[model samples]
Target: MAALRKKPRSPFWFACFTLPDGRRVQRSTKETTRKAAQAKADGWEKLSKERAKARQAHRVIADIYKSAHNKELPDATPRAFITAWLTRRQGELAPASYAAYSGRATHFLSWLEAAADGPMADLETRHFTAYRDALAARVSASTANHGIKLLRVILEDARRDNFIADNPAKDCGLLKQETDTARRPFTLVELRSLMGAADEEWRSMLMFGLYTGQRLGDLARLTWANVDLQAGEIHLRTAKTKRFIRVPICTPLMEHIEGLPAGDDPKAPLHPRAATSKQVTVSRQFGELMAVAGLRAAVNHDASKKGRGSRRAVSELSFHSLRHTATSMMKNAGVSPAVVQDIIGHDSAEMNAQYTHIESKTKRDALDKMPNLLKP
Candidate 1:
C-alpha cells in the first residue's frame, strides 16, 4: 500500500484517490502518520465502493450512525436532555411522584458534577456501578436503588431521543438489596396507650387508620364526600393506587367518625378542616399529634439533620405503619390474600395489571374479620 501523509490544512489526514467518474477524490483518514493514514485510506476506498452500491438503497445515514455509535451524540447534551425529560415529567406525574423524581434527579446531577467525564454518552457501566456502590455505602439499599431507577429512566429517555444509541443503564446490573417485609403492627397495648394519651381528635384518626387500612396520604385527604352514611361504608378513591375502595363502617370506626369535630356546614371535612391540605402540612400536624399521643414514632425535627442514630423500640415506626397494622390485623383475622390485595389496592405483581384471582366467599370472610380488629 502507498504511504499516506497528514494534510496541513486540518487535523484530518487524507490520501489521493480516483472515482469511477474519472474525477479525483481525496478520502479523509482522520488519523495521524503516513503509514496509519495509508491503511485508513485503503479502508475508505472499500467503503466508498460499498456506499456507491448502497446509494440505490438510501441507507447512508443509518450506516453512518451505526458505525459511529461511540463517536457521535445527538443535538443535546445529557444535562439538557435530562432537564427536558424532568420538565415533561412534571406535568405527567402526580405530586408525590414528581417530588420523588425531582429529588432523585437532583442527587444524580450532584454526582455527575463531580464526575471525571460528563455526559451520559461518555459514561460506561463502570461509572454507573461506581455511583451505585457509593450510594449503597452511605444510604439504604432502597434509597440507592431509587437513585439508580431514576437515572435509568433518564437514560432510557436519552436513548429514545437518539441522544444516545443505547442506554448505558439498561445493562448496568445494579446490586439488589434485600427489603424488610416484616409487618410493623402497633400492638394493642401500644394502641390503647396511644389513644388514651392523645386528645379525642387525634385518637379518632389513629383508630380510623387502624380500622380502615387507608394510607396516611389517603386518610389525610378523606372527607365527607367519600363516606356513604346510608350504605354504612367509607368510600375512598385512592390517588396513589388509582382505585376506588369501599370498606364497611364497623361500630368502632363509625363511632369514631361520628364523634369527630364537625362544623355546622354539612359539606365540610369530617376531621379537622386541614386534612385536605398539602401532604407536608398534614404530615407535620400528624407528627405533632403522635407526640401528643405519647407515641414513640419519630417526627422529622429538621430536614437538614443527618445520621441514623439507634432507633427506639417504637422509634423506627412511622405513621405509615398504621396501614401495615390494618393489613396484618386483617390477615390475622382470616382475611384472604386476595381480599387483602383489594383492600390495600396492591396489584399482585409489580408489572401485572390483572388483580389476583380471589374467591368472593374468601373476600366476604376476610371482611367479616374487620370488626374483630379491636382485639389487636
Candidate 2:
C-alpha cells in the first residue's frame, strides 16, 4: 500500500495519510515493521479527520498554532534572543540609543551569568519582581524603571521572533512616576535674578533661550546659516519637535549672535557645542553655571518643600526652564497664543485665518516689550 512505502535507506517507515477532505499528512514511525506503519497511519488518519472537521466547524483561527505537546521546540534563552535582537536592530538605533541598549544588555548578561540554567526560556514574574526590587534598592526609581523598560522591549522582540510564546515582562508593573512638575517657567522675579547672575557665555545662552524658547539641544546646534541676520529672524527646524520655527532674533539675541566669535573658521560651531556631544551636557553645564552665579534654584511642585521654596535653598531647577520662561513671557507680553506656539515650534490644529489667534502685529508688539540684556 502507498501508506506503507519502503524507505530507500532509512530503517524508519514513512506513511502518507490522505484525509477525507483530500489533505495529505506525513508521519514517520521509527518502527521498521509494516504493522507499525499501518497502526501509525490509522491513528494519523483519525487525527487528521478530527482536525479537518474542527477546521470546518470553527473558522476564526484555523490551524494557527500546533499544540506544544506535538512539536519539538528549540531551547531559546533571553540572553541569546536579546543578543540577536541587538544585532538585528543595531543599524536602526541612534548613537545614544545604541550605547544605552548595549549597557542594558551588558547588565542583563551579568545577571544571566549567575543563573544555573543556560538561557531564559520560562522567566517568571517573581524573577522580574526581584530584579526590579533589587534595582530600586540600588538606584533611583526612574533609573530602575528604565532597566525594566529595556528588558520588556527585549522580551517583546523575543516573542515576535517565536523565541517565546508570550512575553513574561508584559504585565510586570513598573514604578509609578510623579507628574513631571520640574521647574519649567521661572516667574518674572526669578528670571531677573537668573539673568542678573549670568556671565558672558551663560548670559548669551540664557538670553537666547528666553527670547527664542529654543531647547538647549537646538540652541547648542544653532548656526549662522540658520540665522537670518538680514531678515532679523532665526530660522530653525527642531530635531525633537520636527517643526519649522522662526523667531525674531530680537536685539538681545542678535547682538549676542553678532558678538560671538564668528566661528573659529566661520565654519566651526557657534559655541564649543556640547563638549560631550550630548544635549544633557549643554543643560548640565548651564546648571553648573547657575550654581556659580549664586542663583537660587526654583521650587518644583513635586520636590520636598520642607527645605525648599527660597531661591537660595530650593532644589528644583533645570536649564530647560528657559524655554517655558520664554513661552510664558511671550504670553504675558500678549503675543497671541497661536504666535507663541508658532515661535516656540509647538503644533497647532487650527491653520485657518479665523482660528489664527496670534497676529504678526501682536508678536511685534510683544517682541518690543521683551527685555534685551544687550541693551545698554
Top TM-score prediction, candidate number:
1
RMSD of each: 13.2, 16.3
Residue 326 lDDT in candidate 2:
77
Residue-by-residue lDDT tens digits, candidate 1, 1-376: 4335566678777777653223456767777676678787777666555534433232345346546896423334555566678888898898888887887777666777744223344554566778887777766666677778878888888767655555666656766655453337777666776666666556666776777777777776777877776777788878787787777776667666675666556556656544657776766677666676676454443554433322212243556778777788788887656678776667557423554455444544565566443454
Q: What is the C-alpha lDDT of each candidate?
A: 0.64, 0.64
Please give, for residues 1-376, the per-residue lDDT of candidate 2 as tens digits.
3376666788888888875346565668777888977888778777667645543432222122224344222235555556667888899886556767878777766775655133344465556667777766655466678988888888887767655445666657897743554566776666666677766656766777788888787777776677667777777887665677677766667667777777535345555545236765665567666666565543243465422222223235667777777777777877677777766777756643446445444555566677665544
Worst lDDT run of 10 residues, candidate 1, spans: 305-314
Q: What's the residue-level lDDT of 25 in candidate 2?
A: 53
In order of listing, the candidates' clash counts read 0, 1
lDDT of 1 at 30: 71
Against the true structure, candidate 1 reaches a TM-score of: 0.63
Off by over 4 Å in 2: 1-76, 94-118, 134-147, 179-181, 192-199, 263-266, 273-276, 294-315, 348-365, 374-376
